[model samples]
Target: MWVRDDVCGLGPYQADLVETYWRWEQDPASLIGYGRQQPESLEARTEGIAHQLRGDNIRFTVYHLTDGTPEPVGVTTLLPDPSVRTAEYVVMLAPEARGMGLGTAATRLTLDYAFHITNLRMVWLKVLAPNKPAVRAYERAGFRTAGTLRQAGYWLGQVCDELLMDTLSSDFSPPSVISPLMP
Candidate 1:
């Protein structure tokens, strides 16, 4: 387990956790803030995880450390661009884990890993504008609003804007004392 603050980095994709991830993707409530709206089959989900594991992406399951056991809560990923020095960040937390500040902690930890361990020069993400809590969380993690793609997504029977945000290694200020777990 890779420890970081209150969470730990868990896997490349294990057979036992595939169903749990599929459940998260199928839940309509969880689809509100995400880009993909379609429900995926079990096989498709398994294939997607396998592809990610074999691709130029670094993914981890976020687990909240509770009492001595790590409870799985979410997932985070860094997809490297062709440039090789930059990447896009994506994170999703289980509904039960939201509002506990885990998102921010996990994001910070991920960013630290990206910049410090992987030596990425920049990281970016596009979030649905209506995801206010997530925008705030990203801002707290040092991401600046770069721009917006107007009416870029369809959700809840309406069009929504997508906010593009990014952060550079020069601008990131990692926690001085946190020891990030290296995979």
Candidate 2:
């Protein structure tokens, strides 16, 4: 399966999976880790959804596993704009994979792509305040709490604050450090 920095050569089956991803993100609450859901069409299935997917100055790329199943486990991407050399980022792991540490691994891989490939100065993501697990993961991943946007989101009938966490290209340490220490 495709499991690298590029999404430029997805075959038909992989492309179909990417389309299904857009459909699944329709629920606002369901998109806690992904930000807001956007409208999509069968005709709009391009290799990269960055130009179409919107949330401030962010964008995303569909990521696949190395297995032959070709199933997509999550989406990841870079956010590049004139005001910041950093790329805004986001990721949403499948529910069943939540505690498996896959999200953190996927995040670190993406960061490596952003910095080494995209040559970004920094990479950042916004997480809802209540998502303690994610916040902790970001912390463990070498991202510091850069700032917070109070009541930045209105999800689940309540105003939710957002934590803007970031890691500089120079600050990101490899997840391999933890892998050796884990059982």
Candidate 3:
């Protein structure tokens, strides 16, 4: 397990966690942030998980460590572009896990792994322009807006711009510990 201060990396896809991912993929509410409205079938979800496990991507099931037992909150992935020593980063959290600081922690942890473990010089991600919270979280984790792809995604029943954000290995600084008194 890759341990950060408040989150740990678990599996590529363990047997017990497959159903959790399947349910997340099928729920419309969950799909909103994922930029998809079509629900995937259980078989498709299974196959997708299998494919990801076999692919070159580094994937992790993020678990929050605030509680005594690790509570699964989301997943983070780094899809490599070996030719350029870069990777595209992606993260998704369960609905119940939102509004907590878990997303930021998970992102930081994954970025650390990408830069340190994989020796990747750059990590980038695309976020729908309307996802303010996510944009802020990514910013808090050291990503800066690189550019925007106009009308590149259909989200919330309309074409939306996608903001490209990235952080170079040299630009990243580990997030500071959150004070308990702060929100």
lDDT (C-alpha) at residue 112 in model 3: 74
Per-residue C-alpha lDDT of model 2 across residues 1-183, encoded as one tens digit per residue = 223432211122234465556555544444655455465565564635444443343334334444544445555556576466777776665554466565666677667656665678988888988887788877766788989999887555577889999899889665332234336
TM for every model, in the order presented, reads 0.89, 0.68, 0.89
Clashes of 1: 0
Predicted candidate 3 versus true structure: per-residue lDDT over 10-100, tens digit per residue: 4444646877867765667567777886777888777777777778888888886777888777888898999999999988888888778
TM-score for candidate 2, please give it.
Answer: 0.68
Ranking according to lDDT, highest score first? 1, 3, 2
Each model's total of backbone clashes = 0, 0, 0
lDDT of each model, Cα atoms only?
0.80, 0.60, 0.79
| lDDT (10s digit) by residue, model 1, range 1-183 | 654664445444455687787786677756878867777799988878777666778888888776588878888889888576999999888888888788887888788878787889999999998888999989988899999999998668789999999999888775622344333
lDDT of 3: 0.79
True-structure RMSD for candidate 2 = 6.7
